[model samples]
Target: MTGITDFTVKGADGGSVSLADYAGQVLLIVNTASKCGFTPQYAGLEALHRDYAERGFAVLAFPCNQFGAQEPGDAAEIASFCSLTYDVTFPVFARVDVNGGSADPLFDRLKADAPGVLGTKAIKWNFTKFLVDRAGHTVARHAPTTKPEDLRAEIEALL
Candidate 1:
């Protein structure tokens, strides 16, 4: 019965961030990578964050290097890339492993709550998004190919 609110994640500044801080907000938790083919999604994600933030929506970015070493930068580098490249204003968390034994606990719960296609729990690639409701429960899992702009309808529904 554990939800995302039960987990704690680290911010890009290496500080602890409680998911509880985001209570009552719809969250689009995305696994990001600066050098991946989906890297441009950062702009779309930023757009969503800006467009719906006042409506209690947020885009939480978590950079990961687990996918083909696509995100090999450190915290500073990741933050800089996000800022300089996409002007991302959303919360970009510390890099984390989104799959395998070393995966972050938050990701573990997310994948379990909303498994991938065909009931597979393994994340297929970066930019994979997990949408969480206001109550911190994961609602849906979007594939790497799913563009952020295409998620407006679902986000509006949750709002």
Candidate 2:
């Protein structure tokens, strides 16, 4: 019975925020890394957030260090890097393990709801994205190689 709105994520400032706060909004949840090869995807993500946020869409980023230690920085450093490097305005939560035993519960639910290629649920790498509809059901899963901008049509369709 668990859905996206039933989950809560740690805010960048260390407080807990329920996904329900984003109720009625389409969500694009991403596992992000500061120094990864896909780091530049932040710009595209930010663009999406800017373009559709007012129209009931949002981009929620969760920094993950589980891959090659690409995101070794603490919350402050990660926030600074995201702001300075990509001018990101969307929510970027505290670092989380997107895979393995220590994975965040929200991500666990995301993967379970929208399994990736061949029904595999574990996120293969950072930048992996899950699209959720307004009612909090995960609709699709995108691989790390999928660019943020490339999902515009899907997002628009949901809108």
How does each model score on TM-score? 0.98, 0.98
Q: By TM-score, how accurate is candidate 2? A: 0.98
Tell me how candidate 2 scores on lDDT: 0.94
What are the lDDT figures for the candidates, one per model?
A: 0.94, 0.94
lDDT of 2 by residue, 56-94 (tens): 999999999988999999999999999999999999998
Model 2 spans with C-alpha error above 4 angstroms: none
Separate clash counts for every candidate: 0, 0
Instruction: For model 1, name the residue pairs that clash.
Output: none
RMSD in order of candidates: 0.7, 0.7
Tell me the tens digit of each residue's lDDT in model 1 across 1-159.
766887899988899999988989999999999999999999999999999999999999999998899999999999999999999999999999989999999998999999998999999899999999998899999999999999999999999
